[model samples]
Target: MGSNSHPAALYQLRIVTRILALVILLLVLVGFLLPTEYRVERSVSINAPLDVVSENMLSGQNLSQWMHVQGGRVESFDGVLQNDDSIRLLYDESDEIGELTLLEHTGNIIRFDVRPKLSTGLVHNRITLEDHASVTEVKWTIEGDLSVGLLSPYLAFFANDIAGQNFEVSLLNLKQQIESQN
Candidate 1:
């Protein structure tokens, strides 16, 4: 008889390939429906006053001393608490030049807009403080947009996993520095 079994195997292979292609297409479509925005918040309670916490978190020199920006060390931070000033950032690598501008400083809240030179979007950060006798709550939040480009929404979905660890480390460092100084 003719090799009908060979034709059957080829048919099965084509079906599998078509299934895989459809699955990939569906995944891409689902990604398009997702959001490209992300917000990450991390907090630590320090045995310090609100003023003390604000000083440490809002001061440029103090911030550069403790905060690690994208695993990069701060070269020089300018315009400490200078409202509406566009403070420039420089890392050891010249290409790491970025812009940080102070947006607001209200009663117990401070906001900033940060844009990395190599990035396509700006990150808006807010630090909120709540004071309780003998212990102060410091909440650090970062939100950003990556545009609606393919894979941007997926990238945002993992933003907390990626940026949260960095924020924890930075906050821990700040806590230690503040507590140690007191």
Candidate 2:
């Protein structure tokens, strides 16, 4: 009876080991198949005019008021926020921490190519304003590739939710700032 019980226990252990091995293999395969690029977008409606929202966004001032950035000031910029204009920002009074180049600045749309000093990937940020009768719809989008080779897929899986939450908070701040000013 003892010998039979020992064989049964060994067989159960083997089965459990095989199941764990298959699960690990499946996870690895899924990781390899996941997309490397990720995009995070968030939007809010502001009770302001399109021109007013555009002015606030293009000025690059009041960024710290709405975003998580602190001690932000425009280091260099074209007078009119045209394409190819470069703006440098410093965080927490540290050295210039990030660079943003204007990719497009047209009616109701502003786009920037952002490069953060701490990151290896390029971030594309676009802010679009759609005019409604009494409110303007503001959409903020950030798109980039993880660029971490094999670990990119795992990182991207959570990128949207994490980044999206940040965007949402910033947008809410922007809305509050604009509404308070009006």
* lDDT for each candidate structure: 0.82, 0.79
Report how far off residue 96 is in candidate 1 (Å).
Answer: 3.5
Best by TM-score: 1
Least accurate 10 contiguous residues by lDDT in model 1: 71-80
Best prediction by lDDT: 1
Candidate 2: residue 40 lDDT (0-100):
87
Candidate 2 deviation (Cα RMSD): 4.1
lDDT of 1 at 92: 64
Q: How well does each candidate superpose onto the true structure, as a TM-score?
A: 0.85, 0.76
Runs in model 2 lying further than 4 Å from the true structure: 1-22, 69-80, 89-96
Task: Put down candidate 1 lDDT per residue, 1-182, tens digits, no spaces.
Answer: 46988898999999999999999999899998988889999999999998888777767677777776774654455546767967666766456678777899876898988886646578899989899986888899999988847889898999999989988988888898899889
